[model samples]
Target: MQIREARADERDALLSVHRAAFGNTEGEAAGDTIATLAAELLDDPTAQPVLSLVAEADRELVGHVLFTPVTLADQAVQGGYILAPLAVLPGVQGRGIGSTLMRAGLEQLRSRGATYVMVLGDPNYYGRAGFATGHQIKTPHEIPYPEAWMAQELVSGALAGLAGTLRCANALNAPEHW
Candidate 1:
Protein backbone atom coordinates (compact mmCIF):
# COMPACT_ATOMS: atom_id res chain seq x y z
CA MET A 1 0.00 0.00 0.00
CA GLN A 2 1.22 3.52 -0.86
CA ILE A 3 -0.15 6.85 0.20
CA ARG A 4 0.78 9.95 -1.74
CA GLU A 5 -0.48 13.14 -3.31
CA ALA A 6 -2.87 12.32 -6.11
CA ARG A 7 -1.67 13.03 -9.62
CA ALA A 8 -3.86 14.57 -12.30
CA ASP A 9 -4.32 11.30 -14.12
CA GLU A 10 -5.76 9.64 -11.02
CA ARG A 11 -8.67 12.04 -10.70
CA ASP A 12 -11.10 9.83 -12.52
CA ALA A 13 -10.31 6.76 -10.46
CA LEU A 14 -10.60 8.76 -7.29
CA LEU A 15 -13.95 10.05 -8.47
CA SER A 16 -15.08 6.50 -9.02
CA VAL A 17 -14.26 5.63 -5.42
CA HIS A 18 -16.10 8.73 -4.27
CA ARG A 19 -19.14 7.81 -6.27
CA ALA A 20 -19.21 4.31 -4.91
CA ALA A 21 -18.79 5.51 -1.37
CA PHE A 22 -21.28 8.37 -1.40
CA GLY A 23 -23.66 7.52 -4.19
CA ASN A 24 -26.21 5.93 -1.88
CA THR A 25 -26.63 9.06 0.18
CA GLU A 26 -25.79 11.72 -2.38
CA GLY A 27 -27.15 9.94 -5.46
CA GLU A 28 -25.22 9.02 -8.60
CA ALA A 29 -25.67 12.45 -10.20
CA ALA A 30 -24.29 14.10 -7.10
CA GLY A 31 -21.09 12.15 -7.52
CA ASP A 32 -20.41 13.80 -10.86
CA THR A 33 -21.05 17.21 -9.34
CA ILE A 34 -18.78 16.38 -6.44
CA ALA A 35 -16.02 15.33 -8.78
CA THR A 36 -16.45 18.42 -10.93
CA LEU A 37 -16.41 20.68 -7.91
CA ALA A 38 -13.33 18.99 -6.56
CA ALA A 39 -11.53 19.55 -9.85
CA GLU A 40 -12.55 23.20 -10.05
CA LEU A 41 -11.69 23.82 -6.41
CA LEU A 42 -8.27 22.27 -6.83
CA ASP A 43 -7.38 24.93 -9.39
CA ASP A 44 -8.36 27.92 -7.29
CA PRO A 45 -5.38 29.96 -6.11
CA THR A 46 -6.77 30.55 -2.67
CA ALA A 47 -7.35 26.83 -2.23
CA GLN A 48 -4.11 25.67 -3.81
CA PRO A 49 -2.49 25.15 -0.46
CA VAL A 50 -5.09 22.61 0.60
CA LEU A 51 -4.05 18.98 0.57
CA SER A 52 -5.56 16.04 -1.27
CA LEU A 53 -4.20 12.63 -0.35
CA VAL A 54 -4.88 9.34 -2.03
CA ALA A 55 -4.23 5.80 -0.91
CA GLU A 56 -3.29 3.27 -3.53
CA ALA A 57 -2.69 -0.44 -3.54
CA ASP A 58 -1.17 -2.20 -6.51
CA ARG A 59 -1.29 1.07 -8.41
CA GLU A 60 -5.04 1.40 -7.98
CA LEU A 61 -6.58 4.34 -6.18
CA VAL A 62 -8.43 2.91 -3.16
CA GLY A 63 -9.19 5.88 -0.97
CA HIS A 64 -9.03 9.68 -0.87
CA VAL A 65 -9.08 12.50 1.68
CA LEU A 66 -9.24 16.27 1.18
CA PHE A 67 -8.38 19.11 3.51
CA THR A 68 -9.09 22.76 2.71
CA PRO A 69 -8.63 26.07 4.46
CA VAL A 70 -11.15 26.93 7.18
CA THR A 71 -11.44 29.63 9.81
CA LEU A 72 -12.92 29.85 13.29
CA ALA A 73 -14.16 33.29 14.28
CA ASP A 74 -13.84 33.83 18.00
CA GLN A 75 -10.07 33.99 18.22
CA ALA A 76 -9.98 35.54 14.79
CA VAL A 77 -7.99 32.40 14.10
CA GLN A 78 -7.42 31.38 10.51
CA GLY A 79 -4.96 28.50 10.37
CA GLY A 80 -7.13 25.41 10.35
CA TYR A 81 -8.66 23.02 7.84
CA ILE A 82 -11.87 21.25 6.96
CA LEU A 83 -11.90 17.57 6.01
CA ALA A 84 -14.32 16.73 3.26
CA PRO A 85 -15.35 13.90 0.99
CA LEU A 86 -13.27 11.18 2.60
CA ALA A 87 -14.07 8.06 0.65
CA VAL A 88 -12.90 4.50 0.21
CA LEU A 89 -13.92 1.92 -2.36
CA PRO A 90 -16.88 0.03 -0.97
CA GLY A 91 -15.15 -3.31 -1.29
CA VAL A 92 -12.25 -1.87 0.73
CA GLN A 93 -14.24 -0.27 3.49
CA GLY A 94 -13.51 -1.49 7.07
CA ARG A 95 -10.08 -2.62 5.98
CA GLY A 96 -8.28 0.54 7.25
CA ILE A 97 -7.79 2.56 4.05
CA GLY A 98 -9.92 5.37 5.42
CA SER A 99 -8.07 5.36 8.71
CA THR A 100 -4.73 5.34 6.98
CA LEU A 101 -5.63 8.28 4.75
CA MET A 102 -7.02 10.23 7.68
CA ARG A 103 -3.96 9.63 9.83
CA ALA A 104 -1.59 10.63 7.08
CA GLY A 105 -3.61 13.71 6.23
CA LEU A 106 -3.80 14.90 9.81
CA GLU A 107 -0.10 14.37 10.35
CA GLN A 108 0.66 16.27 7.19
CA LEU A 109 -1.54 19.16 8.24
CA ARG A 110 0.06 19.37 11.67
CA SER A 111 3.51 19.30 10.16
CA ARG A 112 2.44 22.08 7.80
CA GLY A 113 1.57 24.30 10.79
CA ALA A 114 -2.16 23.84 10.77
CA THR A 115 -3.51 24.75 14.22
CA TYR A 116 -6.73 22.82 14.01
CA VAL A 117 -8.91 20.62 11.82
CA MET A 118 -12.67 20.17 11.58
CA VAL A 119 -14.67 17.38 10.02
CA LEU A 120 -18.36 16.73 9.50
CA GLY A 121 -18.44 12.95 9.89
CA ASP A 122 -19.31 10.05 12.10
CA PRO A 123 -18.24 10.71 15.66
CA ASN A 124 -17.55 7.08 16.32
CA TYR A 125 -15.13 6.98 13.42
CA TYR A 126 -13.51 10.42 13.61
CA GLY A 127 -13.26 10.40 17.39
CA ARG A 128 -10.76 7.60 17.08
CA ALA A 129 -8.59 10.09 15.17
CA GLY A 130 -8.68 12.65 17.99
CA PHE A 131 -11.73 14.60 16.87
CA ALA A 132 -14.18 15.92 19.49
CA THR A 133 -17.64 17.35 19.18
CA GLY A 134 -17.73 21.06 18.32
CA HIS A 135 -20.35 21.55 21.01
CA GLN A 136 -17.69 20.89 23.62
CA ILE A 137 -15.86 23.90 22.26
CA LYS A 138 -18.96 25.95 21.56
CA THR A 139 -18.36 26.16 17.84
CA PRO A 140 -20.71 28.60 16.15
CA HIS A 141 -22.07 26.37 13.45
CA GLU A 142 -25.48 25.04 14.44
CA ILE A 143 -25.03 21.75 12.70
CA PRO A 144 -28.01 19.39 12.73
CA TYR A 145 -25.86 16.39 13.52
CA PRO A 146 -24.07 17.66 16.57
CA GLU A 147 -22.07 14.49 16.96
CA ALA A 148 -21.01 14.65 13.35
CA TRP A 149 -19.48 18.10 13.54
CA MET A 150 -16.11 17.51 15.15
CA ALA A 151 -12.89 19.43 15.69
CA GLN A 152 -9.35 18.40 16.51
CA GLU A 153 -6.77 20.80 17.88
CA LEU A 154 -3.37 19.96 16.52
CA VAL A 155 -1.38 22.28 18.73
CA SER A 156 -1.76 22.28 22.48
CA GLY A 157 -4.22 25.00 23.47
CA ALA A 158 -4.89 25.61 19.81
CA LEU A 159 -8.64 25.84 20.43
CA ALA A 160 -8.60 27.21 23.93
CA GLY A 161 -10.92 30.21 24.27
CA LEU A 162 -11.96 29.83 20.65
CA ALA A 163 -15.57 29.63 19.55
CA GLY A 164 -16.76 30.78 16.16
CA THR A 165 -18.44 29.96 12.90
CA LEU A 166 -16.28 27.72 10.78
CA ARG A 167 -15.78 29.32 7.40
CA CYS A 168 -15.52 26.70 4.67
CA ALA A 169 -13.62 27.32 1.47
CA ASN A 170 -15.47 29.33 -1.16
CA ALA A 171 -15.67 26.25 -3.34
CA LEU A 172 -18.05 24.47 -0.99
CA ASN A 173 -20.50 27.36 -0.94
CA ALA A 174 -20.15 28.37 -4.57
CA PRO A 175 -22.97 27.67 -7.03
CA GLU A 176 -23.13 23.99 -7.99
CA HIS A 177 -22.46 24.82 -11.62
CA TRP A 178 -19.27 26.73 -10.97
Candidate 2:
Protein backbone atom coordinates (compact mmCIF):
# COMPACT_ATOMS: atom_id res chain seq x y z
CA MET A 1 0.00 0.00 0.00
CA GLN A 2 1.10 3.57 -0.71
CA ILE A 3 -0.11 7.02 0.30
CA ARG A 4 0.00 10.06 -1.94
CA GLU A 5 -1.74 13.31 -2.73
CA ALA A 6 -5.15 12.85 -4.19
CA ARG A 7 -5.51 13.80 -7.83
CA ALA A 8 -8.05 16.35 -9.02
CA ASP A 9 -10.26 13.81 -10.75
CA GLU A 10 -10.51 11.32 -7.90
CA ARG A 11 -13.14 13.17 -5.88
CA ASP A 12 -15.80 10.55 -6.43
CA ALA A 13 -13.61 7.76 -5.17
CA LEU A 14 -12.91 9.76 -2.04
CA LEU A 15 -16.62 10.31 -1.54
CA SER A 16 -17.31 6.61 -1.87
CA VAL A 17 -14.66 5.87 0.72
CA HIS A 18 -16.29 8.28 3.13
CA ARG A 19 -19.66 6.70 2.54
CA ALA A 20 -18.32 3.26 3.16
CA ALA A 21 -16.28 4.23 6.19
CA PHE A 22 -18.78 6.28 8.15
CA GLY A 23 -22.13 5.17 9.47
CA ASN A 24 -25.27 6.66 11.08
CA THR A 25 -26.74 6.08 14.54
CA GLU A 26 -28.01 2.66 13.61
CA GLY A 27 -24.62 1.54 12.40
CA GLU A 28 -25.76 1.83 8.82
CA ALA A 29 -24.01 3.68 6.04
CA ALA A 30 -24.58 7.40 6.43
CA GLY A 31 -22.02 8.90 4.13
CA ASP A 32 -23.91 11.63 2.29
CA THR A 33 -23.65 14.08 5.17
CA ILE A 34 -19.90 13.70 5.67
CA ALA A 35 -19.35 13.58 1.94
CA THR A 36 -21.14 16.91 1.63
CA LEU A 37 -18.98 18.26 4.44
CA ALA A 38 -15.88 17.20 2.53
CA ALA A 39 -17.07 18.85 -0.68
CA GLU A 40 -18.04 22.05 1.08
CA LEU A 41 -14.71 22.30 2.89
CA LEU A 42 -12.91 21.68 -0.36
CA ASP A 43 -14.79 24.48 -2.14
CA ASP A 44 -15.55 27.09 0.48
CA PRO A 45 -13.85 30.34 -0.38
CA THR A 46 -13.39 31.17 3.27
CA ALA A 47 -11.57 27.92 3.89
CA GLN A 48 -7.83 28.29 4.26
CA PRO A 49 -7.22 25.78 1.49
CA VAL A 50 -6.63 22.08 2.19
CA LEU A 51 -4.41 19.09 1.72
CA SER A 52 -6.16 15.90 0.73
CA LEU A 53 -4.40 12.53 0.76
CA VAL A 54 -5.36 9.05 -0.30
CA ALA A 55 -4.11 5.58 0.55
CA GLU A 56 -4.05 3.23 -2.36
CA ALA A 57 -3.36 -0.50 -2.46
CA ASP A 58 -3.28 -2.65 -5.52
CA ARG A 59 -4.16 0.48 -7.53
CA GLU A 60 -7.41 0.95 -5.59
CA LEU A 61 -8.14 3.86 -3.30
CA VAL A 62 -8.81 2.55 0.19
CA GLY A 63 -8.70 5.55 2.50
CA HIS A 64 -8.52 9.35 2.71
CA VAL A 65 -7.59 12.20 5.06
CA LEU A 66 -8.06 15.97 4.82
CA PHE A 67 -6.66 19.07 6.48
CA THR A 68 -8.24 22.51 6.26
CA PRO A 69 -7.28 25.90 7.61
CA VAL A 70 -8.39 26.76 11.14
CA THR A 71 -8.28 30.17 12.75
CA LEU A 72 -7.41 30.68 16.37
CA ALA A 73 -8.69 33.29 18.80
CA ASP A 74 -5.23 34.79 18.72
CA GLN A 75 -4.88 35.65 15.08
CA ALA A 76 -1.15 35.86 15.54
CA VAL A 77 -0.88 32.19 16.46
CA GLN A 78 -2.94 30.46 13.83
CA GLY A 79 -4.35 27.07 14.76
CA GLY A 80 -3.23 25.84 11.38
CA TYR A 81 -5.55 23.17 9.94
CA ILE A 82 -8.06 20.88 11.55
CA LEU A 83 -8.29 17.24 10.55
CA ALA A 84 -12.04 17.29 10.35
CA PRO A 85 -12.72 14.05 8.61
CA LEU A 86 -10.75 10.91 7.95
CA ALA A 87 -12.17 7.90 6.19
CA VAL A 88 -11.08 4.39 5.29
CA LEU A 89 -13.16 1.88 3.41
CA PRO A 90 -14.99 -0.38 5.86
CA GLY A 91 -13.27 -3.40 4.40
CA VAL A 92 -9.87 -1.91 5.20
CA GLN A 93 -10.47 -0.20 8.54
CA GLY A 94 -8.00 -2.21 10.65
CA ARG A 95 -5.33 -2.50 8.03
CA GLY A 96 -3.52 0.75 8.99
CA ILE A 97 -4.33 2.56 5.75
CA GLY A 98 -5.85 5.44 7.66
CA SER A 99 -2.86 5.65 9.99
CA THR A 100 -0.40 5.69 7.13
CA LEU A 101 -2.30 8.42 5.35
CA MET A 102 -2.52 10.44 8.54
CA ARG A 103 1.18 10.16 9.39
CA ALA A 104 2.23 11.04 5.88
CA GLY A 105 -0.09 14.02 5.71
CA LEU A 106 1.00 15.36 9.10
CA GLU A 107 4.66 14.95 8.22
CA GLN A 108 4.10 16.91 5.03
CA LEU A 109 2.39 19.65 6.98
CA ARG A 110 5.21 19.74 9.51
CA SER A 111 7.74 20.02 6.71
CA ARG A 112 5.72 22.94 5.40
CA GLY A 113 6.04 24.84 8.71
CA ALA A 114 2.68 24.07 10.26
CA THR A 115 2.31 24.99 13.92
CA TYR A 116 -0.52 22.72 14.98
CA VAL A 117 -3.13 20.19 13.87
CA MET A 118 -6.48 19.66 15.58
CA VAL A 119 -9.26 17.15 15.26
CA LEU A 120 -12.60 16.08 16.69
CA GLY A 121 -12.30 12.35 16.89
CA ASP A 122 -12.00 9.35 19.18
CA PRO A 123 -9.18 9.93 21.60
CA ASN A 124 -8.00 6.34 21.55
CA TYR A 125 -7.62 6.37 17.79
CA TYR A 126 -6.19 9.84 17.42
CA GLY A 127 -4.03 9.36 20.50
CA ARG A 128 -1.97 6.71 18.82
CA ALA A 129 -1.10 9.36 16.25
CA GLY A 130 0.05 11.75 19.03
CA PHE A 131 -3.24 13.56 19.57
CA ALA A 132 -3.96 14.59 23.14
CA THR A 133 -7.06 15.73 25.01
CA GLY A 134 -6.14 19.34 25.11
CA HIS A 135 -6.53 22.16 22.60
CA GLN A 136 -6.87 25.17 24.92
CA ILE A 137 -8.72 26.50 21.90
CA LYS A 138 -12.29 27.08 20.83
CA THR A 139 -14.17 26.49 17.61
CA PRO A 140 -15.58 29.34 15.56
CA HIS A 141 -18.97 27.66 15.75
CA GLU A 142 -20.30 25.86 18.80
CA ILE A 143 -19.58 22.15 18.88
CA PRO A 144 -21.45 19.65 21.08
CA TYR A 145 -18.56 17.30 21.72
CA PRO A 146 -15.96 19.31 23.53
CA GLU A 147 -14.36 16.09 24.64
CA ALA A 148 -13.65 15.09 21.10
CA TRP A 149 -11.74 18.26 20.37
CA MET A 150 -8.04 17.40 20.36
CA ALA A 151 -4.76 18.73 19.02
CA GLN A 152 -1.11 17.88 18.36
CA GLU A 153 1.52 20.52 17.92
CA LEU A 154 3.94 20.10 15.06
CA VAL A 155 6.27 22.82 16.16
CA SER A 156 7.74 22.99 19.63
CA GLY A 157 5.73 25.36 21.78
CA ALA A 158 3.15 25.71 19.05
CA LEU A 159 0.19 25.25 21.40
CA ALA A 160 1.92 26.57 24.46
CA GLY A 161 0.31 30.00 24.23
CA LEU A 162 -2.57 29.01 21.94
CA ALA A 163 -6.08 29.73 23.14
CA GLY A 164 -9.28 31.02 21.61
CA THR A 165 -12.23 29.98 19.53
CA LEU A 166 -11.29 28.01 16.44
CA ARG A 167 -12.75 29.29 13.22
CA CYS A 168 -13.12 26.44 10.83
CA ALA A 169 -13.83 26.60 7.13
CA ASN A 170 -17.36 27.56 6.13
CA ALA A 171 -18.23 23.99 5.28
CA LEU A 172 -17.41 22.84 8.80
CA ASN A 173 -19.21 25.68 10.56
CA ALA A 174 -22.43 23.73 10.69
CA PRO A 175 -23.43 22.86 14.27
CA GLU A 176 -25.35 19.79 13.24
CA HIS A 177 -22.26 18.09 11.93
CA TRP A 178 -20.20 18.93 14.99
Candidate 3:
Protein backbone atom coordinates (compact mmCIF):
# COMPACT_ATOMS: atom_id res chain seq x y z
CA MET A 1 0.00 0.00 0.00
CA GLN A 2 1.10 3.59 -0.66
CA ILE A 3 -0.05 6.96 0.69
CA ARG A 4 0.01 10.28 -1.13
CA GLU A 5 -1.84 13.50 -1.67
CA ALA A 6 -5.11 12.84 -3.45
CA ARG A 7 -5.23 13.78 -7.10
CA ALA A 8 -8.06 15.95 -8.37
CA ASP A 9 -9.39 13.24 -10.64
CA GLU A 10 -9.78 10.86 -7.72
CA ARG A 11 -12.51 12.93 -6.10
CA ASP A 12 -15.25 10.40 -6.88
CA ALA A 13 -13.19 7.49 -5.65
CA LEU A 14 -12.33 9.40 -2.50
CA LEU A 15 -16.00 10.03 -1.85
CA SER A 16 -16.76 6.37 -2.50
CA VAL A 17 -14.29 5.37 0.19
CA HIS A 18 -15.97 7.74 2.63
CA ARG A 19 -19.40 6.43 1.67
CA ALA A 20 -18.38 2.84 2.22
CA ALA A 21 -16.65 3.55 5.48
CA PHE A 22 -19.58 5.37 7.04
CA GLY A 23 -22.34 3.48 5.22
CA ASN A 24 -21.34 0.22 6.84
CA THR A 25 -22.18 1.64 10.25
CA GLU A 26 -24.86 4.32 9.77
CA GLY A 27 -26.56 3.42 6.50
CA GLU A 28 -26.41 5.22 3.15
CA ALA A 29 -27.71 8.56 4.39
CA ALA A 30 -24.93 8.91 6.90
CA GLY A 31 -22.41 7.92 4.28
CA ASP A 32 -23.81 10.44 1.82
CA THR A 33 -23.71 13.16 4.41
CA ILE A 34 -20.05 12.58 5.11
CA ALA A 35 -19.21 12.23 1.44
CA THR A 36 -20.93 15.52 0.74
CA LEU A 37 -19.03 17.21 3.52
CA ALA A 38 -15.78 16.01 2.02
CA ALA A 39 -16.80 17.39 -1.32
CA GLU A 40 -17.80 20.72 0.10
CA LEU A 41 -14.61 21.11 2.07
CA LEU A 42 -12.54 20.50 -1.03
CA ASP A 43 -14.41 23.28 -2.83
CA ASP A 44 -15.25 25.73 -0.07
CA PRO A 45 -13.27 28.95 -0.14
CA THR A 46 -13.23 29.15 3.62
CA ALA A 47 -11.52 25.78 3.61
CA GLN A 48 -8.46 27.03 1.74
CA PRO A 49 -5.04 25.70 2.57
CA VAL A 50 -6.60 22.27 2.84
CA LEU A 51 -4.76 18.99 2.91
CA SER A 52 -6.31 15.86 1.41
CA LEU A 53 -4.60 12.52 1.46
CA VAL A 54 -5.46 9.03 0.19
CA ALA A 55 -4.23 5.52 0.74
CA GLU A 56 -3.99 3.09 -2.11
CA ALA A 57 -3.60 -0.68 -2.18
CA ASP A 58 -3.57 -2.77 -5.32
CA ARG A 59 -3.82 0.46 -7.32
CA GLU A 60 -7.21 1.35 -5.87
CA LEU A 61 -8.03 4.06 -3.39
CA VAL A 62 -8.78 2.54 0.00
CA GLY A 63 -8.67 5.42 2.46
CA HIS A 64 -8.86 9.21 2.66
CA VAL A 65 -8.46 12.07 5.19
CA LEU A 66 -8.98 15.81 5.03
CA PHE A 67 -7.49 18.66 7.03
CA THR A 68 -8.97 22.13 6.81
CA PRO A 69 -8.22 25.50 8.34
CA VAL A 70 -9.57 26.44 11.77
CA THR A 71 -9.24 29.68 13.66
CA LEU A 72 -9.76 31.27 17.03
CA ALA A 73 -12.81 33.51 16.69
CA ASP A 74 -11.79 37.17 16.21
CA GLN A 75 -8.13 36.27 16.48
CA ALA A 76 -5.36 35.13 14.17
CA VAL A 77 -4.07 31.70 14.92
CA GLN A 78 -1.74 30.50 12.25
CA GLY A 79 -1.27 26.82 11.55
CA GLY A 80 -4.53 25.69 13.13
CA TYR A 81 -6.08 22.74 11.28
CA ILE A 82 -8.91 20.34 11.91
CA LEU A 83 -9.04 16.70 10.90
CA ALA A 84 -12.42 15.58 9.68
CA PRO A 85 -14.15 12.79 7.74
CA LEU A 86 -11.24 10.37 7.93
CA ALA A 87 -12.33 7.27 6.07
CA VAL A 88 -10.93 3.90 5.17
CA LEU A 89 -12.76 1.27 3.15
CA PRO A 90 -14.73 -1.10 5.34
CA GLY A 91 -12.71 -4.06 4.08
CA VAL A 92 -9.50 -2.34 5.15
CA GLN A 93 -10.72 -0.95 8.46
CA GLY A 94 -8.59 -2.97 10.86
CA ARG A 95 -5.34 -2.91 8.93
CA GLY A 96 -3.94 0.45 10.19
CA ILE A 97 -4.68 2.24 6.94
CA GLY A 98 -6.45 5.10 8.71
CA SER A 99 -3.69 5.53 11.22
CA THR A 100 -1.03 5.51 8.52
CA LEU A 101 -2.94 8.10 6.55
CA MET A 102 -3.32 10.24 9.66
CA ARG A 103 0.36 10.10 10.46
CA ALA A 104 1.21 11.02 6.92
CA GLY A 105 -1.23 13.95 6.98
CA LEU A 106 0.14 15.21 10.27
CA GLU A 107 3.68 15.03 8.98
CA GLN A 108 2.74 17.02 5.92
CA LEU A 109 0.98 19.60 8.06
CA ARG A 110 3.96 19.84 10.34
CA SER A 111 6.26 20.38 7.39
CA ARG A 112 4.00 23.22 6.34
CA GLY A 113 4.43 24.89 9.73
CA ALA A 114 1.18 23.75 11.29
CA THR A 115 1.06 24.39 14.99
CA TYR A 116 -1.74 22.02 15.89
CA VAL A 117 -4.43 19.72 14.56
CA MET A 118 -7.81 19.01 16.12
CA VAL A 119 -10.07 16.06 15.58
CA LEU A 120 -13.54 15.09 16.72
CA GLY A 121 -13.41 11.32 16.92
CA ASP A 122 -13.21 8.30 19.15
CA PRO A 123 -10.87 8.81 22.07
CA ASN A 124 -9.53 5.29 21.88
CA TYR A 125 -8.83 5.59 18.20
CA TYR A 126 -7.45 9.12 17.93
CA GLY A 127 -5.63 8.91 21.22
CA ARG A 128 -3.31 6.45 19.53
CA ALA A 129 -2.33 9.34 17.29
CA GLY A 130 -1.45 11.62 20.23
CA PHE A 131 -4.61 13.70 20.52
CA ALA A 132 -5.93 14.45 23.99
CA THR A 133 -9.06 15.79 25.63
CA GLY A 134 -9.37 18.69 28.11
CA HIS A 135 -8.01 21.25 25.71
CA GLN A 136 -8.62 24.90 26.60
CA ILE A 137 -9.75 25.70 23.07
CA LYS A 138 -13.48 25.27 22.51
CA THR A 139 -15.30 23.98 19.48
CA PRO A 140 -17.65 26.16 17.51
CA HIS A 141 -20.65 24.22 18.82
CA GLU A 142 -21.24 22.07 21.83
CA ILE A 143 -20.18 18.52 21.15
CA PRO A 144 -22.38 15.65 22.24
CA TYR A 145 -19.34 13.69 23.35
CA PRO A 146 -16.85 16.16 24.64
CA GLU A 147 -14.32 13.48 25.30
CA ALA A 148 -14.23 12.67 21.63
CA TRP A 149 -13.11 16.14 20.71
CA MET A 150 -9.35 16.01 20.73
CA ALA A 151 -6.29 18.00 19.69
CA GLN A 152 -2.59 17.42 19.30
CA GLU A 153 0.26 19.86 19.15
CA LEU A 154 2.24 19.37 15.96
CA VAL A 155 4.87 21.81 17.15
CA SER A 156 5.98 21.79 20.76
CA GLY A 157 4.05 24.32 22.80
CA ALA A 158 1.69 25.00 19.89
CA LEU A 159 -1.33 25.32 22.17
CA ALA A 160 0.42 27.44 24.76
CA GLY A 161 -1.61 30.44 25.84
CA LEU A 162 -4.25 29.71 23.23
CA ALA A 163 -7.82 29.89 24.46
CA GLY A 164 -10.97 30.72 22.55
CA THR A 165 -13.79 29.22 20.52
CA LEU A 166 -12.58 27.46 17.37
CA ARG A 167 -14.13 28.45 14.09
CA CYS A 168 -14.04 25.77 11.44
CA ALA A 169 -14.54 26.27 7.73
CA ASN A 170 -18.09 27.12 6.69
CA ALA A 171 -18.62 23.65 5.29
CA LEU A 172 -18.08 22.22 8.74
CA ASN A 173 -19.72 24.96 10.83
CA ALA A 174 -23.14 23.30 11.00
CA PRO A 175 -24.37 21.97 14.33
CA GLU A 176 -25.01 18.54 12.87
CA HIS A 177 -21.30 18.14 12.22
CA TRP A 178 -20.38 18.74 15.85
Could you tell me how far off, in angstroms, the CA of residue 80 lies in candidate 1 after the best superposition? 0.4
The candidate scoring highest on TM-score is: 3
Question: Residue 141 deviation, candidate 1, in Å?
Answer: 6.4
TM-score of each: 0.86, 0.92, 0.98
* lDDT (tens digit, per residue) of candidate 1 on 1-178: 8989888888778878777777755788877676766765677666658799999998889898888887655556767887876888878799999999999998999999998888877899999989987444433445566778788888888877777666566676563421
Task: Give the candidates in order of TM-score, highest first.
Answer: 3, 2, 1
Candidate 3 residue-wise lDDT, 64-99, digit = tens: 999998989777878899999899999889999999
Across residues 1-178, which tens digit of lDDT does each residue of candidate 2 receive?
A: 9889889899989888887788632244357788878878777888756888999999899998989888775477654888968999887788788888999989999987787998888888999999987668876666676777789999888988788888878788888667
lDDT of 2: 0.82
Q: CA lDDT, every prediction?
A: 0.78, 0.82, 0.94
Report residue 14 deviation for candidate 2 (angstroms). 0.6
Worst 10 residues of 2 by lDDT: 23-32
* Cα RMSD of predicted structure 2: 1.8
